[model samples]
Target: MLLAPENTRFSFALLWTLATFSGFLLSLLFIEIGEKPDIGVLEATVGGFAIALLQGCLLKQPIFCIRWILSSLLGWSIITAIGIGALGWIVPSTEFLPLRILYGAIYGGLGGLGIGLTQWLAISQPMAVVWRWIFVSSASWAIAIPFGSVVGIILRRLTHLFLGEVMGLAITWLVVGILTGINAHKLRS
Candidate 1:
């Protein structure tokens, strides 16, 4: 019976999806309370963690999945994909690509680092810097965005016919990193 599973068993993706749905709801609340919509790069990273909180209701999470890297990757990837896409769609851009793939590198790097941190802490960090809190806000993004932006270089290099040489990946990395770092620092206080 130990190996036999019932339909009651839920997949990790589904659980995460539920958490994501909850975080999305909270994001709307942030906008509503602020009375204005703002799409900062780190918004997704933080919000993704906020989504993770919903897990507390379903399981005794602080549950470790694949040691550390996967957790960091999931956090950063979900954050970047949702955050960047939303920003592009919600905000009007005079000049910018709809989706920035360069963020993958940033996602990979920061995600890697966060994984290291969590592993070093054994995923037992306190709730104030809670996994859930990271989901719905921009804190984690602030920490990871600059690193995420680095993907732009590879993107530009590979797609020479389109983005060309003026994409400014360097600037994007610098700005996103500084801003995300500052914002996360502020939130931590």
Candidate 2:
């Protein structure tokens, strides 16, 4: 969790939005232009680190910023890999779109929970408050699944196939992250 100052929720939200947007663009450029998913992953990791560092700077917590960077890198990578792997395992060979979506939601929720748990631990906040935060994060992540699928489908139909999917994924994360940030601000209030 970020150690933000008073009345900085809006600023934090704006920072997160911009960071995610840049991350999305960087990832797309890596994959589409550079033709490398590995590079895309690296770019995403650097973006996460940038977000963490910026948040820390805004919050006036330099030490926590370093922790956040490492945490974000490890947390994001592990959670995404697990979620994707689980999705594959859970809905293997499924032709039914709904079932696939359901599997996606489940895995996304699980990954979100894991990431939130780590954040809660890092912040060392009260159990009650952290539990609510985790729930909000997980729910938002789960909700992104179907929404992302819809966005991906629509974009693919309207544009280049792979580029559309990348855009959908980026937009999905942007929406979910913003919603989660807003909810977190509400909880803080």
Candidate 3:
């Protein structure tokens, strides 16, 4: 079945969401629940590569795809490393809901900034069209992480599910994908 032009945006959102969630899942293989710098690096590198590769597939330009993946890898790795160093690995606890949410937002926002800036370098578009992506990326991640944290915490507490944080991570990526996908379509145009 063929998709209409307008449907492309939705496709991008869906693909992005899936990609990010899958990336997070893949990261779990190597990541332990800890504050180690190596954990952060591994999480970012593995997750970022998966996310970028899948996202890049949506782009028409081959060179753009390559640049996107490379930039994303570099950006995610550096920012995650810095964030781990500064903030450590944050796990949501029921005791400090508000603080956890705040920390999640800060970490997500910083990560977005790093990824966006690096990706920005790869785009050939005019600054006006492309610049909004940085802010959009930041806002998307900021909102996503907190929302995910709340959901994850609730699920863990209520259901007694192991790895409830995985759900939270998926939700976080879903939000990021939807918001960023819309912006990405605009940037592409």
Candidate 4:
């Protein structure tokens, strides 16, 4: 099993796929629970960036702009699919979906740096010792995702505690962190 360290277009493409799929899944999660405006791009932004930066900092990979664009669009596709498909569950709000999508891109683009920063803070070192990055990132994600989601929903006075943003990203970290561990073990082997 050769889990190639992300280095080039191919790796970023894979990252885009994973991020998009995860975003779609997260959006589906909302649809299942009767959400209409539920977005997915935010999740992919955070998750893709999370994994991208992880691979970049740990493996010294390079991710370009195209990857981000594709990832964001893919994530938004899920939102569109659910918003259009699930009519019964979706409540048409005054908030413009198109505007939200645009806002998601803008925010995701800017906030995407959180991913790189998280990776840099936690996974910059290349040592054979047991690292504490996973725990640190996990803790931070927990606080950040839930806090943002809860506060945003509350401020808007919404009912659902949906955190399609950084939550999936934390899950991605769990999986990719395992990948990183495997890569380390393989190196040792």
Candidate 5:
């Protein structure tokens, strides 16, 4: 298989970011329909679907697209379910920047592992190259969440915006898309 072009990688990142952001906004509407845990699962499912659908479009092999989407949905939902179940025990409530970043990294890493493992099934690559994806995915989210959360908090406080969380999520997705996009290109190449 030929390597994916640079523009294609960029397109993948851009689409992934937009789709995820939009999915998050749509998921927010379901907040009143269920309990917090249920809602979190719902959000993860929606976000995963949206993200995978768009990201799959950029895949060199069209045959794997559906598998990609399904795997992502399953991965995200399962991970979110686990995370929700362990929320209080695994992560503590804290406003401290360092703690927040640490917790975010931990949470993001686990979530990334879940998603990466599932998504790995759809990737057509050697084990050596593909295994790096799991780490890349984990690191991407590990960095993105904390940076986005901190920025979102600061922006919310400074502007007093009601939907400042959206901004933070946007930043998070952007970072994720960029990091994963580059790695994906390298993997495929």
Candidate 6:
């Protein structure tokens, strides 16, 4: 019997997908139950940080884990602050749904950029691998928000109000996972 070569890329992607999915689901549940937004944020932060640490473990790089944790936390905080600050200005309180979605996509992309840059600086991977990391992370984040918003809109139309965003997030993370896996493999090679 011949065994297939171990693909760390796929493993990393799968783990990331599961972690993000779980975090989004938990946030949705809290939203449905009328919990505070802070709870959701906290849950998501913890989940993301935990998953990042796991990735470090898989890569046998404790420095990457620590950097990821710090970077993720800082990136999220900065983005969230910017989003709130810009909400009334760029995405007025009375803005239409589509506009809001666009804003989210832009914000997500920027935040992802920060995370990607941090990953590149901290991971000590080859230049190409680091570049790929930046590109994939930024693109995934940028695309996910709008895609999720669309899903949410459709679900709302279908009267599945709560699940729409959740479904959108799932789809986004699925794509991210696939991309991450591919890149991980490439990096290994």
Superposed on all Cα atoms, the candidates' RMSDs to the truth, in angstroms, are 13.2, 5.9, 2.9, 14.9, 4.5, 5.1
Higher-scoring candidate on lDDT, 4 or 5:
5
Candidate 2 backbone collisions, by pair: none
- lDDT per residue (tens digit) for residues 131-160 in model 5: 898888878878877776677667767889
The C-alpha lDDT values of all candidates are: 0.37, 0.55, 0.71, 0.36, 0.65, 0.54
Candidate 6 local lDDT, residue 57: 45
- Using lDDT as the measure, the top candidate is 3
Task: Compute the lDDT of residue 22 as modeled in candidate 5.
Answer: 56
Q: At residue 156, what lDDT does model 3 achieve?
A: 72
C-alpha TM-score for every candidate: 0.33, 0.69, 0.84, 0.26, 0.78, 0.68
Report the C-alpha lDDT of model 1 over 84-167, residue by residue, as the tens digit. 332211222212432333343344344434433433332444655544434423433333333333344345558863242223
Query: Can you write out model 3's per-residue Cα lDDT over 1-189, one digit (the tens) per residue?
Result: 988988987777676667666655565565554433435676667667877887887777899889988988888778866753211124554437898698788887887877788889778888876678888887888888788778777777788874676576667777787778777876554
Candidate 6 global CA lDDT score: 0.54
On the 0 to 100 scale, the lDDT of residue 169 in model 3 is 61
Error of 5 at 118 (Å): 1.1
- lDDT tens readout by residue for model 6, 49-103: 5445544544545665677567665554444454422110121222267784776
Better of 1 and 3 by lDDT: 3
Q: What's the lDDT for candidate 3?
A: 0.71
TM match of model 1 to true structure: 0.33
Worst 10 residues of 1 by lDDT: 86-95
Residue 11 accuracy (lDDT) in model 3: 74
Clashing pairs in 5: none
Q: Whose TM-score is higher: candidate 4's or candidate 5's?
A: 5
